[model samples]
Target: MSSPLFTSVHVGGRQATHRVVMAPMTRARSTQPGDVPNAMNARYYSQRASAALIVTEATQVSPQGKGYSFTPGIYSPEQIAGWRLVTEAVHAEGGRIFAQLWHVGRMSHADFHNGDLPVAPSAVAFEGKIWKVDPATGKGEMVDCPTPRALDRDEIRDIVSDFRRAARNAIDAGFDGVEIHGANGYLVDQFLRTTSNVRTDEYGGSRENRLRFLKELVCEVAAEVGANRTAIRLAPFLTARGMACPDILPTILEAVEFLEAQQVAYVHLVEADWDDAPQFTEEFRRQVRARFRGTIIVAGNYDVERANWVLQHGYADLVAFGRPFVANPDLPARLAQGLPIADFDPATLFGGQDHGYTDYSPMQQAA
Candidate 1:
């Protein structure tokens, strides 16, 4: 029997070996001072090169875009060179990679930004705690995020340019493409949700205006690098940890239509963060599929069986595995061979060494 997981798929004219994709996961392992990608990360990504498409961890575009400690960036030359090592390592094994560009928006503390307050669509502060690294002890610290400064019109233009520069840097770093991190309550997402953006300017007040920043970013990046090499990730119905959005279906439809017009490579959607949250109904799924003519990758707590079913049923063209890929580097092979998946240690999910990052052994090694 043919396995849908192993079926070959084409994204942006490039043929992928399998339908399994490695979703971008923030490990928070990059050391401070420069946030350069190191050999350890290179090895970590190379180990999972079997994925048809490996969207890298979220990388901030500029210093002002930073939200957490130890996350990598693509703005600096040193950072670009560092990412080059990772891309080269992954490509050596014939794997395609995409860099995820990010900005934390209101989900950041001044401690990580040289005493500068984090920026957001509005001045509202995220009503939760964020994990930061304690410089004194080098351990993770839970800190309350402060209210952000609402970006002015000029600031918005500068932020878009930052994304454009980051896209250029990703290409220079040897990435096959770049995935704009428009999801998970980041800057782009802050503008999308009505609760977060209460401005009366051109960026806010209505649904169409709310999606302006993200749409402009997509167009700008697509101009820099062809639309075929650009993708966007969105968390449509996610409302947790102060990341709430009202009327998700209509908002998503608007964004999807805009993306369709741009002819982007794909639209990566995260239906909801929590399992108990409403799943994407077949009708809503069809609506998105009809709106987006390009590839569609659905993620968020999907197992092998569900992933295969979604693909075979024609709901999603590709399925992205997040925590599963972290705990199982050989996830594609395991799904192909029907091998047992090792349990993931949730305790070691963030800010860990090689214990959970690169130490997940393949089935052959375990045997």
Candidate 2:
């Protein structure tokens, strides 16, 4: 039998031609000053339109939501106009695209907020680096994140409104839909984990409390845009960014139930792929499948065979390839033909020019 990847699937009330999804990847190439998407970004995504769905890189919902340098935003009118170009480009190529709205929370440095500390559910700080451009040198570098100021009850509500507005802005900018980035070690993820959130308020302490922020944000976004056009990304067992919680698996399972009840189009799970990363067991997969009967999109370091295997096993409805699509603009076509692909230059990945961004020729052009 032929691979199910090529089969049409209904998503967000639209029929996507294939089950190959382009995962939201952080390619920090947007224009600076305003953090707006540009023609280069439009070309970059449109080139990979063969994927059934393309989730844009994590876009800041507001200036305060920004964590990295050069990442795009959806808050300003200029930003919206910029994104419209990207959406139009992808649509012209007959592709479906969703904006991945983001709020980095404490995963940010003070420089972005005029030396003000970033806000989170708790004051805890993760032991990691965040992208920032040096004020003196104007060169981008990863800097240590300080202990963020915890958000008060009223502030939390404001952030929720920000997410809802971002969803509306995405629709106005001509996106097919929007996906709330509740995964990784960002804002929503911070609130979900016990280690990061230790407040005794209604949003902290117990598991249900930890899940409150995510639930509220999702509800706002889904209400702004129908659940059919809303989705979420979750990393259940991620530990790289100090996300290893003893009860994280069950917490995510419960979150999935909430998302399922909301009728979200899909839940994108970011699997462990780095060296010695914690394993997402088949048992866990089964549990997720049982709870979330809606579409499941799994992303790891999956190749063609692995992607097809998961789809066949009822583990995932779609597989997302990140780095592969960087060098192989026509990744779906290459995968369909079992063709070889080139590796992307690692150095040119973040805050770069057109060299590694869109210069990767298709197979025919390279030949």
All candidates: TM-score: 0.96, 0.98
In terms of lDDT, the poorest run of 10 residues in model 2 is 10-19
Candidate 2 achieves a global lDDT of 0.90
Candidate 2 Cα errors over 4 Å, as ranges:
none
Which candidate tops TM-score?
2
Candidate 1: lDDT of 337?
82
Listing every candidate in turn, what is its Cα RMSD in Å to the true structure after a full C-alpha superposition? 1.4, 1.1
Over 4 Å off, model 1: none
Q: Which candidate is the best by lDDT?
A: 2
